[model samples]
Target: MKPDLPTDLTWPHTSINNNAHRVGFWILAHLTHDPAYMEKVREEIDAAYLTQGPSAEPDMGLLLCDCPQLDAIWHETMWLYNTASAIRKATRACAVGGKRVSVGDQVMATFRQFHLNRELFGGDAGAFRPARFLDDKSLARRKGYAPFGGGHTYCPGRLFAQREIYLFVAETLRRFYLELVGGAEGTMMPGVDRNTPSAAAMGPERDVEVVLSVQKL
Candidate 1:
């Protein structure tokens, strides 16, 4: 199970820690499924290493992390596989559409739903494309692509989370080339099973598994 981000929680730390192996595995899976993306990342990493050397690792410094392209991949993944899909209300209130609301209102926003919104992210939004965020202004104006959240209730530990995510991904990519296993296609959808065990805030039922290979880079 992965630790999900909350509108109020700081970072996806649990999600990052508990699901690191899972996330790492899926990263490999996606790379295998799309060799092109893998090649692009490899090229960037290679170039960075050429100038700064491999010792200038992502977890070590802000060197490679300043790369926009690398950041995009992290954003896309968070969108596609947010840890939690539901947000519970603490008080009664009126909804935006003039609808009456109440305390304990269970509002759910699946990561897949928002992440794949075609209006916000164009051209096969369902498909994972890191290059989509290359245009800084456009990416900013996308409006609804909030993998973390907005406002004062915004995620507190976002900086920490981003650092961990970027570091983890950069290190994983730097160490090994990835590929999917058992000919599986990546699926970022949730499952249903109320009886399942959960270690985080996410519901007891959520299926997130992607098997992939990790070969020496």
Candidate 2:
């Protein structure tokens, strides 16, 4: 008999950690590279914490809920740059999209595919536009766009991860002014073949080295 334990218990721990880093890095890269977007993000942050001084920490609950703009940024960032792929086994035979799926057949759901669907994301699916998500939260509900997966197989720590990332970002912005050095442009390059276990959820399979100056207030 098989043990009653999750096959990949450590998967969630690593996945959540890497995802949080990815989100934070993407936010930093995107904002610093684009003046317009950076200003928007700064404006939202400034407005939300206008009453609080730099020394005082902004309430996490307020930061999480009050700033729709920031939330939109998080959603858009995840939609565009997410690297998570969910592999699920069909419980019963079913036909989907003109293809028949048998019980126990493995189905891989990739976030990149779903998030880039022109039907749901429009012709400029490749563009970095936060308004797309901010305009309508429903856009995030489109099928196959599972940043943290979905339904029964959804990530258990999705909410906790989001809060963790939001707090990291908010607190960082609160304490330091981060600006990129050498002006590394934020663009999505095609991913290359990799032998890592988390390859499917990796963006570009490479890193752009950028120096950032974080000055404390």
Candidate 3:
């Protein structure tokens, strides 16, 4: 964003690339931690690529339009574990739920609070249920989910970000079979810092290690 300097993407590229890697890790971890979920993903992926051989490339259009299970898992991942924060400033003074705010006041919208709202996500809100998204298509987008910022300030790289993440899942399914590093399965979930979610990254409090084995094509 510097006008004085020549156009360079070293920083932007690094940031986006790192985020993609983190997303890949989280997806694999979730799949490993929950064998049932992993089976669901494998079934979906296998069905998706049935017409085209394992070595064949996936059709992006089919993925974007009709891949239900993949879409569910990806959306649920962001809905449940995302750590992106959106900060907004009050343009005009107003009252919110009996709380008053001034024009100059700044409001931070933390996903930790909003995404996990009991009323919005329902009773089993804490559970990782991808079916919610699959079941409710009408009212889901209007609720507490905002993995990427919405409205005018939405992430410009949203499409690219999605495609990149999809490629990670699709390519890995085609090339490698995922496995957990240690015997520790879905025994524990990491603690995350709810106060501040990093830029373009939404994940656990600590790092998770995963292993993948090459599959015969």
Candidate 4:
């Protein structure tokens, strides 16, 4: 007999697939923009694979835990590209940011504003610097860095989404070399499509053409 599925089953699938695609797109775009950074991430992935033993197969544990560069890239991508907003209702009367919040009042928090906040993220907050995350451990735990939401309503599929992006990036780079079709001088970085309504991650305004070749392993 077939098992029944819940009516909200599509929520997870939509959230994971849509947000992952957008996030992955930005990651690749940034990597293509900076070849040196790409090589750094590639080297990290290679080292992790080598440490996993002779088969050279990717170990989920290492991918999730061992590669600091990849982790930083992922975090930077989320910080720069995610446009998700968190909506919460005030359970009781309180003051936030000096604004009085009445009971049952709805408050919206925009991730983009927080992500781009110069005070919390430093002077280069608007820039896509993966090293920011690596250099500052406290940034991830800060109240302003809520890529997957927070509190009890935090995204349940966050781990799954992260794992999927990590595996995709690691495996793709492991077997292939990718570059923009026209090189950095000829091609410009795509702009964010802010005009579109995005529930999570936002996408590029234009498509970037890339050339992928099998690695000479």
Candidate 5:
């Protein structure tokens, strides 16, 4: 079960209030683009008994948000799409291994490098394969994939955000069908250069787009 938060601490007031939509969008984009993962997600959702009344068999509201499988999907998506570099300030002036180090030295950890590291992620880290997380050994190797930051400064809203994204994607797929319009493809994938702007305040730009048709399934 997911931890409960105070109602007063509701979103828009939370750390991720403003960025939730953007984050959720990226999560769905990755899922929709990867046929294998998408199929799995749909299959799981389909297994839940459907109902026409307010009370459904699976209580999809909870399944889409708090389910383990859905959360895993969100975690994988974040690991693959982390674009922001983590920054830390050094504490206490000191020398490390004879090298002089000063207090407050700005340190940047570009997680993107490690996230895409083939040595750590296997032969083809660039590939979007959620199955990598299904294996206990492989998932254990991803201990350093901290897209939500770490330590005392870690994001408290991480769990909430993941839940939100899961529900959003599930409901979207269950509802209307989405289709990429003509010419949308040309505008989909943008340059990924450092100079290129992100889809969000800190998201990386990628070159790819797929039109979708949203009809009832």
Candidate 6:
């Protein structure tokens, strides 16, 4: 007989669902804000599927490995919007950053501090520039890019969550053209709602309406 898993084991399941949607929303919003970048990504998606054949469906291998632009956007989105924190309790007394910790003390590490650090991400760390990841692959592997938390507790479903977002963005862009509703003002990027209690992903402070038109084949 199979043994039942602990209820907390469901945390990753719930977390991925909660996080993926928010991440996807911001990704789409960022793409809409930059039409040139959107078109570039769309073209990359088109090219990927074209290689498979005119009547073929998307290949998981291509989606996961072949699309560098899409992957860069995903990394940048995580850098700009991820607000998740890693928390751990001390089994024994220890020191961190010159501070002494008592046994059983809980320590929380906020990802944004590293993500937005100019030293790590450069002068435009505050800006949403996906090319940074594309230009420098090492950026994603750096300690600063910890969207999935870190150490042994690193997110177990990160790969699944990434594929889910990638498929969502690729298919949506391939099938439809999305644009912000208003003229100039609508193109403005929405402000992030940083005040929300600690979450796996940050959300927009205000809603921005968008119009979607079916793409012509």
Best by lDDT: 6
TM-score of 2: 0.77
Question: What would the TM-score be for candidate 3 when compared with the true structure?
Answer: 0.79
Would you list the C-alpha lDDT of every candidate in the order shown? 0.55, 0.70, 0.71, 0.84, 0.59, 0.85
Model 2, 120-182: lDDT tens per residue? 679998688888887777876777667877778777888888888887777776666655444
| Candidate 6: Cα lDDT at 185 | 62
lDDT of 4 by residue, 1-217 (tens): 9899787778787796679988888888888778999999888888767544334677788878988888898999888888778899999999999999999999999988999999888888988889988998777888799899887778988898998888788878888888788766437888889798888898789888888898765
All candidates' TM-scores? Answer: 0.61, 0.77, 0.79, 0.89, 0.67, 0.90
Q: After superposition, how far is residue 42 of candidate 5 from its true place, in Å?
A: 1.5
Cα lDDT of candidate 6 equals: 0.85
| TM-score pick, better of 3 and 4 | 4
Output the worst ten-in-a-row residue range by lDDT, candidate 1: 198-207
Would you give me the overall lDDT of model 1?
A: 0.55
Candidate 1 per-residue lDDT over residues 8-84, each given as its tens digit: 64345565554444444445455555668777776665555534544554323443455665666665565554544
Off by over 4 Å in 5: 1-18, 34-36, 48-50, 53-72, 94-100, 137-141, 182-217
Superior by lDDT: candidate 3 or candidate 6: 6
- What's the best-to-worst order under lDDT? 6, 4, 3, 2, 5, 1
Among all candidates shown, the one with the greatest TM-score: 6
For lDDT, candidate 1 versus 3, the one ahead is 3
How high is the lDDT of residue 117 in model 5?
83
lDDT of candidate 6 over 9-31, digit per residue (tens)? 56866686668988999889989
